[model samples]
Target chain A: MTTPPETTTASTAPAPVLAPPRGTRLTLRDASIGRQGTPVLEGLALDIAPGEILTVVGPSGCGKSTLLRTLAGLLPPLAGEVDRDGIPITGPDAERALIFQDDALLPWRTLRANVELPLAIKGVGRRERRARAEGWLERVGLDGHGARLPHRVSGGQRQRVQLARALAGEPRAVLMDEPFGALDAQTRAGMQQLLAEVLRGTGATVVFVTHDVDEALFLGDRVALLGTGTGRVPHVLDVPRPRDRTAHDDPATVELRRTVLTSLGT
Target chain B: MTVRHLLRLLSLVAALGLWQLLTAFDVSVWLRFEQFPTVVDVAREFGERVGSEAYWQDLTDSLSRIVTGFVLAAVAGVAAGTAIARSRLAADLLGPVLEVLRPIPAIALVPVAILLFPSNEQGIVFITFTAAFFPVMVSTRHAVRALTPVWEEAVRTMGGGRWRVLGSVVLPGALPGILGGLSVGIGVSWICVISAEMISGEYGVGYRTWQDYTVVDYPGVLVGMVTIGALGWLTSTAVEVLGRRVTRWLPRTESRAEAPAPRRSPSWGRSLAGAADPGPLTSTKEA
Candidate 1:
């Protein structure tokens, strides 16, 4: 639970707003990670509810990425626990999908084949995999791009294809590490809008990491402010709804934004 | 001429002219055109052999051996590379050993190879395998290791098993790299195979060259050398063409990874201008 700061919802500045619960999707408890015998991230705890967008905003090299890596099961947690619907965290599973910022699509794969990769790994039938991939591609507005190679697509589109690949498997929750951070401001905005729409339709829980305060407020159901090194607990804030955030209309959300900006240590 | 083309053409011509000049100057009577075969004599021998069924058949036999060795390496290399890549322990244990031995020329291994094998033929084949394996292994390992993590993540997220991931994501992703290795391997295999035969075997271009050497048929020996070089060049080029066909979707950067030149950006000015929404300054934007 985040400590609610002073009221500033009435202020002109943009802030965060929170939507009520659908379900508990992902829960982190005292989870820490280490690499090569040294600790990189320390005790961290948070829970993101279903249909909720939780943005993790933090300083550079703050183990924000490590935390996300632990969640994704790319790296083992050195200490503590992660719970997915009451089950203890284990090896990487289908319910927890992670999207990297760099797109990271295989160079040899076509956009459609890249998306189909996960299903193929699962040994899913070819026809079914194609169908699932095509549906998700349509959802992400990249239909007819199945044959195109990763290098042939624009950076933004490659990321979108990655987004589609993540969603195609129909995971219970999605973990993104600054997915839109690499894109230009305009493309980033369009992606954010696309993500919001996707989130709304699917009702899957999302825990996204980013550096931008505005992006966190605009997209997150709640935002967690992770500090620089030895990242402590987040100063979680609620995100405002109907998110046309350039003109903030509420005092509570505005107050939270100011509080978040301050917590960012600017 | 452009610098690269000129350099290539000049080196080749210079080499031939030097050989001719050396013959004219009679640098060594045994190596001179009087005692040895002039360029024309060897070319004539090659032309005469082209119309002979026995020569054509010998060429096929040698090709079959080289192809067999190359194919074996390809299959084994791809499998081993993926396995090592997926397992840290396997890579740690095997990678260093491979690297240590990879630098030793395959041709140099023929004497030891002959001692290990029962016959000259087996030794030569072993030599061919050794030449092909290292490059194939190196290529495969690189291809597998270089695969982006997102590909595996994508696979696991989609409920893919380890094997599925290997087959679907890792294998295809590594194809371009593997192909590059294979092209080099194919070229090297021929070199070693011919050397192996010349050193000890009873048949093939290598054996034929050694026979010519013993008989003082210097023109025949020159013909043999040219045939071996030409065969190596042809087969490797063919492999490269095949690799390109199989991995059409891979990026130019990755596909041409083995080549030594920096890539120039393709002309996108015309395409950009003709696009539905043209930018003020036209250039191909990497998607």
Candidate 2:
């Protein structure tokens, strides 16, 4: 509850003292992840390179979210090992940020306050917290609307706030679970482009989970397809470079999309 | 005033007029209306009582007792409820005892209160606290339990510990429900406190009303009933207003129409398109 120190100057610009984000290496070695005692995705072996965007796509109940939870260290793998930079992740850590499909922004908090939550938890100074939150809000194109509560804003804006909030923590890895799935097609496309633009310089590894094939192909450097049936290992595929909306029409991209859709049985 | 406001006022006036007619004409059907005090007689009695020092003393005594009991119950009930909801150990320790005591009417504890407390005032206050506590505790437990798990996950992923999660998420998330319990608690406290005052020796409104009944002062009894009704309405309304103010973040359907435009340019269309979306309004029931 400490008040931010008073500034000597009348300048409004906040000094950006954020440390450069460093990506973490996440490795899942023959991991079996699930809720309770049941295994959802068994014998899952995936190594996510530093600063890589790995989008996971699968049918409903294919353990897409469970895998993301495992990566975030919210839920431990039922068997096998899940590690970050060679160390086994035992619990949730500040180095990893998780974005949920549901509007998880605290409804009671202002958009700026929501974004400032991680920084507060990290014991950041009030002045620095305000500056970083403002910076992230502007980064997500929500500069002047930080004072509004989650319910006051549109669903899409809330998602933007969530993105801002996650990035404000300056986590080494960002785990997103269908973050843009609830938005309209146009808004979702906008979010995808915004997310790509925002992550360009952060150097944070991202694990994006979605059911949409187009979304998976567009946002991911590499796509991992988890089949609907249990005991099926995730089939990893490399997406063609120079991510573009029109790239979906390319022969190689189209073949990959078809292969993914066919594997998913859609 | 609007037609609705006028209609509400008219409804009360009509009821009063019907009561006057029944008593004036001595319409003794299945119910004995002949023995009832007329509206005018009660109004006169109320006027006389309002100017008297004895009436004021009774009013203040009852008010103080209710306020003290209610405040204590609110603090204790919310803390206990949150603990029960959040911790398995607390639930195991306190849950069974509360469940057994919850079903007994607070008014029926008159003899127990008389035996346990040294003074009549303490007994009445104790009864009031007991009446308020269960409703507040039950509502808060449900509220805390009902909060979505995603919020806690979001905070934890941000490296918040257990205490931070409780302060930032659980407490605020369960506030509306706790307030709901408080509102219900206040009403029940009034009912029990008045009954307790009547059963035992007291100088409160309830005691005065019982004394009037013994003396066949029907008009004085009517005045006491009216005063109790008004006091209960006022306190409950105050709690509801406080609840609304504290939980203002909760989406109110009525405010959607007048809400400012969506902050981002792209969401303007989506906002308009989904104007009919009720959002989370259905889950939050205002007092």
Candidate 3:
């Protein structure tokens, strides 16, 4: 069932006054991704339209992370290719950003500096990059914490810093590998809500990988459930409107959550 | 002021007291207790020589050799280690040679060093370099290899090329290990420089100790020993302080743990600082 990508209004936070540039379409062409000659995901074909959030849910070893890494161009596919805007992804590019679970903020940099890394790598001018980094940090609710080291902040706060870093580059696509997995449930919920708010009108396509079904349904326009036995995605559940937490308690979402849970076998 | 400090002072006093009693009472004629200098005599000699120009010259000579050798070893070791860890070609070419050379003690190479270099100073410096090089190299390699793959991947995914990845991720990620190597290298370099001086060259703390031994100047030997120990302590302290400064972004707790109160210095504490990733020869290499 086709749904309008941009027309869905948020039931919680108000949409941003001006929408950011929409993300480029990302597609996998019969891609087979793996580690060291062993295929983890084989013969997979999926299209992620621009300006949408796609969440991947699977059991621990079902290669959810492998799938994200492949998209980020960090890992080579075993058989096929991942393409962005119809061009093969040769390697990592500035247009796509990956958010790691460990909040891989350079242990040598302050929060502002970590957020500034991608811009610096892109050869952005000093003052402009710093301003953008600061803006992103403030948007992520880390206004005064920019000078703090990553280790000095809590796991939830570090996750926010990571999100700021990912978005600061104004990437067309963001691949998150359990970005909030290390945080507690309360913090995870808060981060998920914040993510939904900040990303609502930004139009940056996001592929979020998580084992939690509720998180998958709450934040994704489509929830992709990967079966343990099959290396490919078995199901992609579309929600009428994502970013609607009240929908989470509705009978329809509850049934969909059950379906995702059954697919995950937990 | 602290219990630890009190215990350390008491331990030192007890050691000196035992030595003084042994010499005073002449506990065993066969043990050469009579030939041993008393604590008071050694202390007086230490006091007398502490301000002497000859002692100062020896101190400067030894300090210069250790600092030069240690700095050279640190720079070369980190470069070589990065190359070896990051490139298969470098590892293949240099790995076996370094492995073979690493085991031979720098002291054992003193004669060979003298033959190879133009002057005794260069020869002594060469020995110290050899002593410092292996530990720094091995530790840095371990640090580089043990770096979390995510750090590099993060940089790469952000459009950082090879050199950017090396500068942004590899160097900083490997720093704790490099610092570990430096601290150990400084200590080892001191040992080697002094030993090389005593064995081959002139005008160093080790040489002075050896000279005193030859001339049967017993108290003078103690003075030289104390001087060498203090110099080694100061140099290692400087390295540790620098290490802490460079890694300031680390959590306060982790950084604070790296530099413990120098008074209660335990060998394992140093190892603990670098224990996040245990290199192959971590335990044995420090010596």
Say which candidate scores most in TM-score: 2
* Residue lDDT tens for model 2, A29-130: 989999998998888899998899999998889998898888888898999989887678899979999999966999988888999999999999999999
- Local accuracy of candidate 3 as per-residue lDDT tens digits, A4-79: 5564243322345365346867888788888897888787888888888999998888888888888888888888
By DockQ thresholds, what CAPRI class is model 2? Answer: acceptable
Residue A141 alpha-carbon offset, candidate 3, angstroms = 1.1
Best candidate, DockQ-wise?
2
lDDT of 2 by residue, B42-62 (tens): 999999999999999998999
Best by lDDT: 2
lDDT: worst 10-residue window of model 2 chain B:
B278-287
lDDT of 3: 0.82
* lDDT sort, best first: 2, 3, 1
Q: Chain B TM-score per candidate, please.
A: 0.76, 0.87, 0.84
Task: Mark the regions of model 1 whose C-alpha exceeds 4 Å error after superposition.
Answer: A1-24, A122-124, A249-252, B1-31, B92-104, B253-287
TM-score for the A chain of candidate 2:
0.91
Error of 1 at A123 (Å): 4.3
Q: For every model in order, what is the iRMS? A: 7.9, 7.2, 13.1
| Candidate 2 positional error at B169, Å | 1.6
Which ten contiguous residues of candidate 2 chain A have the minimum total lDDT? A8-17
